[model samples]
Target: MFWRRWCGLFLDQKRRKKSDATYKNYKHILGEFVDQLPASVRFIDQVNADVLDSHMRYLESEKAAPKTISNKMMVVSFMLKAAGVATPSKMMELPTVEEEIPEPYTREDLQALFKAMTPEERVRYTFFLDTACREKEVAHAQWADLIDGKYWVRKKTFKARGGKERQFSPKSHETRLIPLTRELMDMLNARRKSSKSQRIFPNEWGDPEGHFLRKFKAVAKEAGLNCGECETTISEGRFTKHPAEVSCLTRPVCEKHYLHRLRKTCATFWHEKHIPIRTIQSWLGHKSLETTQKYYVASAIPRIVPPPCSYSRRICSNSSTLVLLSTRSSLGAVRPEAESRVYGFQ
Candidate 1:
């Protein structure tokens, strides 16, 4: 007794586990390859390396982003693997690992966005973006689970571990706690009166809403919270076009991809803070730090402090310190003890 589109291929649980937009995007991308094939190629057996390479070429020619191509490949490979078909390795030659730099949110943008959001939505969404919490966990965060200052993220939803409905994991790793600042705690307290229900954010509907990509886009657009707006540099000034690359907020706008950009933006802010790669990995929920490195390479998170040479003595004392060190080395007194007494390193 299977339903339409089920095809006994992907089960309902697996499908629901993925966020709606991700599921939809995977379907759309996979269709590009599947729809072009003859019935023979659609069979799991036909999905060999050669066939996969052909699809990637089409994606490249059609101008799909590298990350998009990669995600599509993951979905296709996952589907094939699930059916016990060997996934071809040729799909590994992706479009050079998505090198486009991520645009970090401006201080103005962050301030305006958070101020625009209500205490609850702001707390929940920022925590989600910052910690890479699964959409469900953000929806169901509870006061009990949120220890005032610690690493903790309990899974009251998507309880796949045991009969217990809720489980604990850091919001970043969903397996360990990182750190919680006063900002988050204050937010919780502000929402405390309304936190009578178990959920940090309880939807009127009892169940957690499975679909929010569109809704998030709409809300983000209204609040100017999303950094996804396409920016265009013109003779007058640079400005962004709201929501899509389709229209312009100002005349003569440049092109930018928005929501995913925001994700990269979140990663960049964390990266710039000198956060460790493993920490960023946990924050992004990537199984491998290699995946996390891709983010640093892609986002180009600016170093919080400019290079010592770039700063004049007026700007930063580090440049002056370097000069003094060079003078000391010329005097042949380059030991740390000699410098420590003067520089106070010891």
Candidate 2:
């Protein structure tokens, strides 16, 4: 069978089993692989260890990240296996992928971002930072998900304007309860009274808003948080002879300002409060405690201990208030008596 035909069959199987995003990713990667194949090799049987190695070389030459290359190789290997072709053992040697440390937003960054947002936008982002919910989860959030003052993350079915029902599931199909601070609860309650849609944050059409990252980048740009060195090409039109290359200095494009960073920030804060690894993992809805530790809680350990009887108070950068208090022992020794207290915005 032709290579493209075999790939089409494989993708059809995936289309039924995978999410839309996953299916699209598979199609994109496989399309790139097929495009890179030599003209002489037109069939699945024509793909060999040399072809696989050459593809790997091409990916490396393009400067793809090690993790990205590994993922593409996995997809290609799966396709070959499905086509009844045995992949060479030598070709299975994947590159080492180092886990990157998480970068949570700093207090100053949070302050600046919040300052650039309107009141409604501030509340929306505050919900993101406080609950540590993923973008999809937040988008699909509804008042019905709240139970006993905690938000429940689970599969939900939403109906669109045309009466088409779509089901949304959490990543890894794992569900957990997320507790909300009193301040966040109050803010949500106020929002609920005025909200006409079931979704906590809905668009004008009463559906989950999907342009969060774009709007967030705009806010970050307004706050002067963009890294001006990054460059990208933008097409003027579909048939434009030449696209214009631009730098981040001309656009609000920064890799650092994203919703996931807030989730990491929340997890790090819990870690700094001495929360157990298992607890943080559950709160993060991570299937593995190792994932929670490696990505979110690894570098949050306090490096220095301050003296007792010294209290530090600061307005929460995200429009809240936080205070750290310590008391002197009866024996005249100073030590922390309790964890830091965080108050929500009034």
Candidate 3:
């Protein structure tokens, strides 16, 4: 069969079990790839190493990001493999993209975002920042998941290895229990009193698959946490202004203050409170301790100042004053009794 025909068949097979969004993404990326191919190449077998290498060059010339190129390549690789074709051995030499470290949201940033949110937004946003659930996990949460002031995040939808779609409980098929703070509990109680849908945080249409990021960014833009401003322009006799793009802030705001950052922020908050790395790993639903330690945990050392000790002047020389250099422990705080004994002037 021709590569295009095979692609259409693969897409149809995927659409039967996968989501429209996933299907659309694969189709779009594959379509773009096909556009860059030579018109004479009709069969899947005709697409060789040289064609792929040329396509990579084309993608690079178009200024596609390294990550984007890698994703597109994954689609191509999958399609080729599915059609009983082997990838070129030399095609393994793709661009090495560095993983960017996730930056957590600051307490001040969360506070600002909270202040700008509506009551409904506040309840949902606070849940994300507190629970550290991924966007999809939070979207799938139901009132039934709330048990004894804790939420059990059971995975509802997942994309398995090889881009196969399935409905299951979380990424690791594990249910995570996240303790609810008093604030979160209050929000839940309030929501439960008025909510009609089974899902705790649902869209206006009461769909379980809610678009949380849209609301999150809306609140973020209003809070001035973002760096750009929306300027209205009349194009083709239509006036339009994207409020999300409109910003007056002079300083560059970190664009990483999205929903995922809230998850990182939750992890960071726990790390700051002296929570063990392993404990944090389970709470954040991380598969590896390395993942928890390397990405989620922040490197902030707490700065706790010890209280000044009052000493008798009679014990020391009359003209000489004792200088006690303020020191901190690994735990960041020194006990009041320990402080006096260590720095006593004699």
Candidate 4:
């Protein structure tokens, strides 16, 4: 009976959001947790900090990354709290083992990626890759947000809790105005052609850029790039006389997977740009600065190419001064005007 009651609480938690996407995430996460529990120990008293630890251990033994298992733990903790089930007092703090830092795409890799994309997609995804804007935000961007070289995001679509949506202004957390380039602005204006409504990245269907994975795979295929399966092979850059490639999955994958990669890569790029960790904390949509710092590690591995010159160049006219610094201690922004011309060390 208590087990059934807790299950009811779980369903109630899921029902708080009616949106398919929102509910889907909650169901997949919490549902999986409950399903794996032994039936005999499914009641409220049987669930405790020790059992939670055991479940976490199960997750780790199954080869889950620390971050992933941590997320699952958070979901479980939240659920238990909502159900009035208390964690054990002695073992309340469930510590997670640290994992290796994530590898993100390099600036060179980004150049190849965007260059391979069509003009429109290049504009859209560059903003996504840079700002770490959620897919919906990228798709629904408005020209009104653009002001000078920066823009604001209105939170009309933050969530669909009920008939009403929470309306918060951009950077409501700390007032986040994402900066953009003239080219990005121009692309936004050019793309806002009249036939459709106010969507920034409308698909062929003229919807809010819905079919993301489908289009992503198509673009990847066209660009001679790979996704999950072959992403590493090409990333290794082990190509010989003939560049080796990998097979792409025919099915469209989840948007979050790609978004995670894009978001992490954006943090890495900004880290290289010498942007302050606090600034990057805002850009990456992290609530805590500690969560943000994990991704901005300094790598010592040297690239074959020499650093760009310390002068602003017209190579990518849209790009501002190319900033390249060697060490964390020595920090400055170089215009790199002539940096494009020098590739001796690079």
Candidate 5:
């Protein structure tokens, strides 16, 4: 069968079982693969070792990340296998994909990001940090999903008038419950009383908001937290007919600023609070505990400690004298205070 025909068959098999995002991703990968195929290679059987190698080379030439390349290649292998062709493993070696370390946002970074957001944006992002839910899960969350002080992540189906069906489900099709803090619960209750839509957060059209990452980057830029070094080519308004390469310095397109980092930060916070790996995995709705350990449990908290001398200069720059005061407090009650003085020259 032709490459496109085989790809269609494979996608049809996946369409019913996979989530919309997964189905779209698989379709995109297969479409790209078919597009990159040589004209001579029409049938699945014509896809030999050399063809796989050439495809890998094309992916590398496009400067795709190692993990992305591996994922695409895996999809290609699946397609070939579904078509009863020999898989790439028997003929060629796959590229090694390095394990990526998760980088969660620090308290300071979170503060800056929150400071840059509006009141409405803060509430939306606060839900992200408190729940550690994926973007889609958060977007699709409804008041009905919250039951007895816990938020349930589950599959939801929407039926169209023409008998067509659309479904929204958690990643891996795993449904789990996450407990919320009292403060968050109180806030949510207030919003619930005032909200007109069924969704906890909704756009002007009363649908789940989808363009969160773009707004997040804007907040990062407004907070002056953007790295301002990364650059990419993109097309803008009608005035700019041609795509222009731009830097993050001019545009709010920093790689470091994203909604997922908030999720990672929340997971890391849970880990730091002595939460068990299995529990964290369940809260994250991960099918495997290894994912929680590999990404969240092993993530490090960013820290910066200044030298002792620098601390004095930085704290008391104008004065030659420094007084260190310590206080003991319990339950908002002050107990005692101790004072020490140090003389220093600027």
Candidate 6:
């Protein structure tokens, strides 16, 4: 009945090669609901809005976060729609999280952190900052992915989903090339000579590296970076050396400074160099220009405009004033054309 259709739909998603992380979450959420269903409710049609209302109450009773509750509800709604079941009336709306500007590291901060890392850690972090790559992209990268001093990130990555690992593309299924800096290129070329694993960054078992947050935070701690956000003590002032899940904890501590900050840092650097936002979006593998605009770009706009008579042309009506204005604009004077494109600034 309902159980048979659920299994069939789940298997169909797997067969069609949907994202592993997505399917895993759907399965977990759906499984919980099925288990909670009353013994009398056995048919698909029996699972209606009332049943879903009970499920919502059940999640609230368990003290689930608003975002979590919303996600679970969406998953169930999608599942029910696939099975041709009616959705609950006025279902739970998604929580509105405040949009905060991404905090990218200053050049000095980046240098200090780089200096504190070990040779291996330095190379890895340096590559991330230079390329603006996601952690999963780093995990799935192979030596063969590099060509002409650039690395190509594609769908040929092994990802963990549904309690098992399989080859798949993550995030956007689009492929992109990241150009390597000369220093980073040289460093990687040297490492490639004696590397035993096919992966660019491999675990001790010669597999794609997974969950390197502990090691990254350890390096940050040694670098004297304040990490009061991620560090939670056990009892009587005993700090946890390497917690298994750093991100799943409360308050999203990595809000200010974390590994992902490096990606944003790279984007900010490009923006500072006057690189176009569309180009930055492509390099960062963002699905839309809005994602690049909202996160990667800096919120600060410099106040460099002069008063009414600041421009040479405004002071003198002579044609030579126009030449002086052009010269001054070239020498870092306010250029309205450039400023106009930056976050709609006039």
Each prediction's Cα lDDT score?
0.50, 0.74, 0.66, 0.55, 0.73, 0.63
Please tell me which model should have the higher TM-score, number 4 or number 6: 6
Q: 103-158, model 3: which lDDT tens digit per residue?
A: 87654565567666766776787788778888878877889889876788885654
Name the candidate, 1 or 2, with the larger lDDT value.
2
Compose the digit string of candidate 2's lDDT tens values, residues 155-244.
987786677677788997888887665556667898999989989999889988888888888888987899888777766667656777
Q: Over the stretch 231-287, how does candidate 1's per-residue lDDT look in tens digits?
A: 533343248434432333432232432344455665665565455677667656668
Residue 282, model 4: lDDT of 69
Candidate 2, lDDT over the whole model: 0.74
How do all the candidates rank in terms of TM-score, highest first? 2, 5, 3, 6, 4, 1
In terms of lDDT, which candidate is strongest?
Answer: 2
Structural similarity to truth (TM-score) of each candidate: 0.57, 0.79, 0.74, 0.64, 0.78, 0.69
List candidate 3 segments past 4 Å from native.
Answer: 87-90, 157-169, 229-254, 296-346
lDDT of 6 by residue, 55-86 (tens): 88898898887778777887777777677665
Alpha carbon lDDT of residue 63, candidate 6? 81
RMSD of 3: 12.1
Better of 4 and 5 by lDDT: 5
Clashing pairs in 3: 155-170, 228-247, 229-245, 229-246, 229-247, 230-245, 230-246
Which residue pairs show collisions in model 6?
none
Q: Quick one: how many clashes does candidate 1 have? A: 5
Clashing pairs in 2: none
Counting clashing residue pairs in each candidate, in order, gives 5, 0, 7, 14, 0, 0
